[model samples]
Target: MFLYFLTLVLMVMGLYCLIAKKNIVKKIIGIVIMEYSINLFLILIGYKKDGIAPILLKNVSVEELTSRGVDPLPQALVLTSIVIGLGTLALMVAICLRIYEKYKTFDMSKINKLKG
Candidate 1:
């Protein structure tokens, strides 16, 4: 229950930063935080109190393996999500650099020439 509450708080804080902050860099940071929080939550879902690595040996029986091993699906999903997050973060940073080069300021309001 405590873990769930902490995860929820992390998620909310990340979302608040993403939605309320105007700086492009801060938004990128918020996005990264959100991604990490979600990854943490996913990992928590597959956690077992006494989990062991999921490996299948020739001598291992099906029932024994099922009862002792950790779930691999969430680990795979977290890897994919982390890769996607890195790609997005890179793109966001590149765009922010371009914006800075053009506008000479990190302030979002000052860069709002598109507002009409």
Candidate 2:
């Protein structure tokens, strides 16, 4: 669908940001964008038109549940991925801050030149 194509485009944009940017913060933002795009893709994979939540109600038959329920696995995976992404983002920002403290610049080329 168009959504999948959009997701791919978003990922490519993120990749471009990661590869083409010079600032450490911008690179970090690119990584976050890529992560978010992947999460969006996963969510799209599990989506169903006119689907209900996977939760079972007393009145719902097994057949009906199977026919209409959206998948829960991808949602769970996305939740876990979000937590992991947050941790990684924090770590990256901390490293960037330390690099700035040492080099006085967020520019990668400058940082490389200043490296002892």
Instruction: Report each candidate's C-alpha RMSD, comma-separated, in the order given.
Output: 1.7, 1.9
Scored by TM-score, the top model is 2
List candidate 1 segments past 4 Å from native.
Answer: 58-61
The alpha-carbon deviation from the true structure for residue 55 of candidate 1, after best TM-score superposition, in angstroms, is 0.9
**What does candidate 1 score on TM?**
0.89
Which residue pairs collide, candidate 1? none
Instruction: Tell me how candidate 2 scores on lDDT.
Output: 0.95
Tell me the tens digit of each residue's lDDT in model 1 across 1-116: 78977888898888999889888798788888888999999998888778877898888787878998889899999999999999998899999999999999877878877755
Taken over the whole model, the C-alpha lDDT of each candidate is: 0.87, 0.95
lDDT of 2 by residue, 10-115 (tens): 9999999999999999999999999999999999999999999898899988898999999999999999999999999999999999999999999997876544
TM-score of each: 0.89, 0.93
Show the lowest summed lDDT stretch of 10 residues, model 2. Answer: 107-116
